[model samples]
Target: MNPKASPGHALSIIPREQHTISRKNISKAALRVLYRLNEAGYDAYLVGGAVRDLLLGGHPKDFDVATNATPDEVKKLFRNCRLIGRRFRLAHVVYGNEIIEVATFRGTSDEEGDRHVVDGRIVRDNVWGSIEEDALRRDFRVNAMYYDISDFSVRDYVGGMQDLHNRVLHLIGDPATRYREDPVRMLRAARLAAKLNFRIDPKAAAPFAELGPLLSGVAPARLFDESLKLFLTGHGLKSFQMLEGCGLLKFMFPATARAIRRGDRALCMLIEQGLENTDARISEGKSVTPAFLFAVLLWGEVRDLAHTWMSHGKDGNDAWSRAAAHVVSEQCQRVAIPRRFTIAMEEIWALQPRFEQIQRKKVFRLLAHPRFRAAFDFLLLRGAESQAMEELGRWWAHAQQLPHETLAAALPAQHVGGDVDTGVPAPARKRRRRRKPAGKSGAS
Candidate 1:
């Protein structure tokens, strides 16, 4: 065990038969990597999330290996291996569709290693050390355990087994220091707690309020990847609640936090329902898109902003457009949402007002739109906003079930050119008449 491991935490080794983990459960590709590394006289083990998930009887999608071999050495062992990462060098051993990630045991910064830090954050870490040091370097105690491939046993350096059994997440070292090293760990804490249905230890969660702002300094692109992990996973609603409880939501999604803070119960309902539906779809293995998820998350802000703009005498279309652009712009500054998803999000928002136009031509036009299905799904989420919105959603739902010709035949003949919500005609433009030329009036 590392001398610096938490006090009273000595190494605990659970023999192969003592634990539920079996080699058969692990991916064959991962096993091949582990066996090859061990045969090459390197200390190799299956580590981190794979071990934790297997212990809980869950099937992990990815398997990662931690070994004593350097990136170059690992590359030599397998011709298919490729080194990746600037912040933390790693080896990726590709096996057709699945890639097994192999990482070197991370050492402490105090040691003579090539680790770099800036403003308390680890910008680059290539340090290599013993397995004990690697365990200590992990973020959470539950993620610190290692599955030894040699003895077919498990090694615990920070009481990870007990913490895992108790369904609690405990940070490995000083909470604030670890969070500063990588603020994304704060988001990870919330995500893991929701994913595993575990409670975060108080000591681990205490620093979130102060350290959450550090996430702003992280790259928007990195945050975007983290956002997918938090929201796209099957436990999105739970993860969302966890983020809110930790008071970290504002740092990641300022617009969403602000909208929620306004006490719009309907808005909250809409967001929750959207997440629930997303979770359900994922559970059923149905395809999902980031565009729809983002549209739902940012809708409260866009709706409120558009209404505010319209109240200030802006055209309805202009108000909605500006509001969508502003919110998506502000959000991308933090999450770096790709332009593709942002464009789809905008289209979904722009379709809201059009949903109120039940005229035959407009209805058919909307039905044929590429974004119509996604936008219609978004409209259904707004049913929690009001009875009128609910009725509108129901109308569209019923319209989609009918044949196009039949639906067109059921629509009103006259087109109403004003805001659909208020049922008032738009202001009419005064016609300007052209003056006739005098054209030789004297001769006439």
Candidate 2:
């Protein structure tokens, strides 16, 4: 008898054939991982969104596997595996370009570890249990469905398959209590609704407004992760719309919410265009930058604040710098952008004034800037909103085609200084004031 398998245990159960009648489309990668685990004497099954998405005829962004094997056991089975996550220990198996995430089963908070509080938040976790217990602990019913490789059957512990068919997003257990466990689920509700085009069950939607504020208790880093998922994904426009409807956007980006509510049409159009552009680029396998995304999103707030400062007698450049700092700082309270993206944002903002000062060969120098393409893209977006600066955008497009000398000649003569050596112009020298006569002091 195998020592790991209990006497009379069903370890030798025949592998089940694929469920052809079911609509769930399993990925080749996920199937291989599941089979590999099962053949090694571990109880492995396909779990979470992968199963749900397959049932719904949608391709899951990623696949997750759950098994009865302990984290240590799972690590020992795969040579390329690395154990990760402090809150929820899981194994990541690197298979060249693809990665397979395997998580052990978790039970209720009362089963193993004592509950503890961290910064006024209760973290009830660390228990390991049967797969059924793990299923019950998941966030959403649709995400709790599991695919049993042994029986080729889909397990509906929380009616996940039913909820998926119903086109509804329902909380796994109690709505409010589950939110208390992890408030990011509320944001996930919005993301799923937008991404899958599913409706939130009335019970689930009901608690969102009252429980939305719970998100503030979450760590800034986690909030940052969710913010990217909410706004940078292809469905950002729709997710934002849903978030606004639920009164959740205000907590994440108060300034942006205020601008949107204040009828900032320019800002709205720019955001829509930027999201559309990002989605298109992503679909084409092109690279996208978070800094550019943030810069465009916050541009309206920055412009509004800067204009207000300029209205109060500050120079445009000075007002812009102050307003950029103020706006970025305010946003950091929610998203906690890293220093690199923050620096990129500053560069993007600092280039705006240079856009207006496009004269002489300075245009080429501006073009050489690391953020020039993004800045120019933003400029075009602003023109789309303001309409008044349409010619500026056209000029930029036209200048791109011209040779260096031709581009230089198009600039105004007044801006063409003599050379780099003598930075000051003759006009500036002539404007200097003369010293007062000493006779005036004697007369006094």
Candidate 3:
């Protein structure tokens, strides 16, 4: 134990018929894992976020099983089990679309087993211990509770039940020490607080700003996964506000934080509005893309960088391209955005200038672009910065709805003002002087 964590209260167990979480509420695959583990003579319980979410009457996205059985033992019992990870060995029971994560009880990092502590952080930990030790090793009190399959009771060793009822998020031990052990926990603190609409305890939130930089040491790939959970899962706006409040946003996205701090009100509103749109779409079961969301978040900084480059005499297109690349590269160093989304984001930014080119052929070509819808949404968000942009969005909106002939007639040959002149039609092809037809060429 950290010496700061509560020694723990007497275990509270609620029997089968007493709780709202019926076996049917749990995923069948998870139920199978639990039953098998129990049948194999090992303790198995539905644990972590699933238990927390179930108690709060919310449907858990997935289920996890914690057991006294080691990964190898668990693997021996289930033919479908695949052992994964070294930091914490886990057995994943796969059933087509669903996976049940089974983890062995984790022992303390302060002990001398398979755990390794380097510079206050536990870089590797796979030490197995009892259920009580496992509960103590969890980051939050709410996530420490368990749903036992044997007696169909919830096991609460920490004050998770009380904290859940109080609508509070509390760290299990001394926050500073725990935070040092895994700075990503800070991000989790913000995310869970936002997702559950729970207030973080003062003690838990106090060390956030001071420990924000610790996240830099975490894996960029892990941070990318965390980013999705924060922004794409229907509670983006709240999650963003929480990340900003705790000073972790800059660590994750330095360019965005700089833009916000520079009093870019338009950028701020665009981000909030974009998040609002995403949340609404997710709630309505519409598909959302990572490319569009990332474009919205990084546009202001990219635009500013482009402007600086243009002032130094770089061509407008080159400047935009460079800016997009620069910002994306910087962000990638912190969160590994896969190439596909990054490429889409760049296309969305590059198309902004093309929006001003409403010539008949240009308009048709832009409309035919695969990324048109995403770029158009990004353009709409940019409407906050310029009247020309707002008018351009409106024109595109109307044009897309117009009859073909009517749209052709509506073009007046001059209505583009997006910091670029795109209204000039392609130069009329030069007529070749006819030779004397080798003697009688056509008279011009």
RMSD of 2: 7.4
Model 1 pairs whose backbones collide: none
CA lDDT of every candidate: 0.90, 0.75, 0.88
TM-scores for all candidates: the values are 0.93, 0.84, 0.91
lDDT of 2 by residue, 313-381 (tens): 999889989998999998887888887998888888888778666555566689889789888887787
In candidate 1, where is summed lDDT lowest over 10 consecutive residues?
418-427
Our tally of clashes for model 3 stands at: 4
Superior by lDDT: candidate 1 or candidate 2: 1
Question: Which model scores highest in TM-score?
Answer: 1
274 Cα displacement, candidate 2 (Å): 1.0
Error of 3 at 65 (Å): 0.3
The lDDT, on a scale of 0 to 1, for candidate 3 is 0.88
Ranking by TM-score: 1, 3, 2
Error of 1 at 346 (Å): 0.3
lDDT of 1 at 260: 99
